[model samples]
Target: MYTLAVCAEMVFRDLPIEERARRLHDAGFQVEIWDWTRHDLAALERTGAVFSSMTGYIRGSLTDEDDAAELLRTAEESVKAAALLGCPRLNLHGTGLDGRGLPVDPVAGEATGPMWIAAHRTLGRVAELGESAGVVFTLENLNTAVDHPGVPFAKAADTLALVAAVNRPGLKMNLDLYHAQIGEGNLIELVRRAHGLGLIGEIQVADVPGRCEPGTGEIAYPAVARALADLGYDGTVAMEAWASGDDDLALDRFRTAFTV
Candidate 1:
């Protein structure tokens, strides 16, 4: 089944978290929580949304054994928490390239060699832990630093490389279109590559220039959506957009784009 998820950061800011989740469920969307700190698994159980792991706030990359162990513990807990909420996947961001929030040079930045190595090592442990907990761990590419300041792995190639390095079944790509539009020029080509590598697990979308609803921006969303459909991608095609101070208007725009 093709699934829909609303990034929690966009929808749950003003409302109670549970209420946000309930609304998503009512609107026919499965919820994907982002950078969420307040709600727990018990709360997720009450609401129908699936919980994906939020990263970047946790620490550095998942590549170091010691650091990986710590993340394993956290992932284990998140898995248990998500299980309570009946979620099947936990998503993460790669490590930050620089502490100063500069765009990472793909070839030389800390997030490149050692950091990438560390992420592989870290996620290897995460994969083992996640298997036992029944949670699938996925890593997503953020928009280039100009958009996701201080984050690492902005391009699709970097995320795919990290997944290949780990070579673990649990690790895969989150593949958000908003980020892809900013950094990648060819969506279909990249998606095809990810499929060939078995790296894509989840997908999301928003338009650029303002990260607003699909129809309101310049992205070729219809083509992108068609590409996703052609791939037989049945996972969540979440709308990761900002609300225009009017929740109904934002959701209406989302519904229109997705109704197909």
Candidate 2:
């Protein structure tokens, strides 16, 4: 059996977070807090989506620096927020090293060494802080080639490296298949590899190319599901897809993919 959560932004708009949680309950899906700005602990208590996790980092209102100390402070606050809301997980990323639009020559230690070092230091602090707060920090991959090209961890291997460098139990990888399929196409193989290494903390899915509902595109989700089951992966498989109309189509697609 696969537990499903929908990215909050994908299913619900900028309405009150409590109303969004109510709608998620009505739709029979858990809410994955994609937009942290809209989070409400009271709403979480009412909706029971507290068991769910989020995607992005806590922004300006949350933290204001890129150094290790700042990262630790931010992680502490995020854990406090999660615990206050009864959330157990908070998905995070290695930002700030994103060149934005600058040209980098790898030969000049341009984008690789500095970015990796910063990620290692910052996320290491996050790991330490999260450990004390009992909240897991899941680092996700971004599709840097086409979408979000400036992000540092744009591939699966890069995310894995960061986690390894942090070398903490509280820090884990968030393997969202949508980004994986687009950025690293060996879906089943990579899942198997991550499982083999005991690194994957969570997994998510959606069709590639367009990040739409499953079964509407080219990803072999059934095979991926089989691989996950084979690895005894019983974690939440959140849906991070776009819904042009009714999200029932998206839900149906997941039902087909997971066969639940």
**Residues 151-182, candidate 1, lDDT per residue (tens digit)?**
66667777888877888777778887778878
* Cα-lDDT of candidate 2: 0.68
TM-score of each predicted structure versus truth: 0.85, 0.85
- The runs of at least 3 residues in candidate 1 whose Cα sits more than 4 Å from the true structure, single-residue gaps closed, are 50-57, 63-66, 96-110
Please give the range of 10 consecutive residues that has the lowest summed lDDT in model 2. Answer: 101-110
Worst 10 residues of 1 by lDDT: 99-108
lDDT of 2 by residue, 1-260 (tens): 55677776665556666776767667777767764544656656776553578643443111223444554555566776676667777887544222242212112212466666766767776777678778778888767665565555657888887787787978889888888888879888888887787777778777877777788789989888887877788777888787655666667777678863
Clashes of each: 5, 0
* Residue 47 Cα positional deviation in candidate 2, in Å, after optimal superposition: 2.1
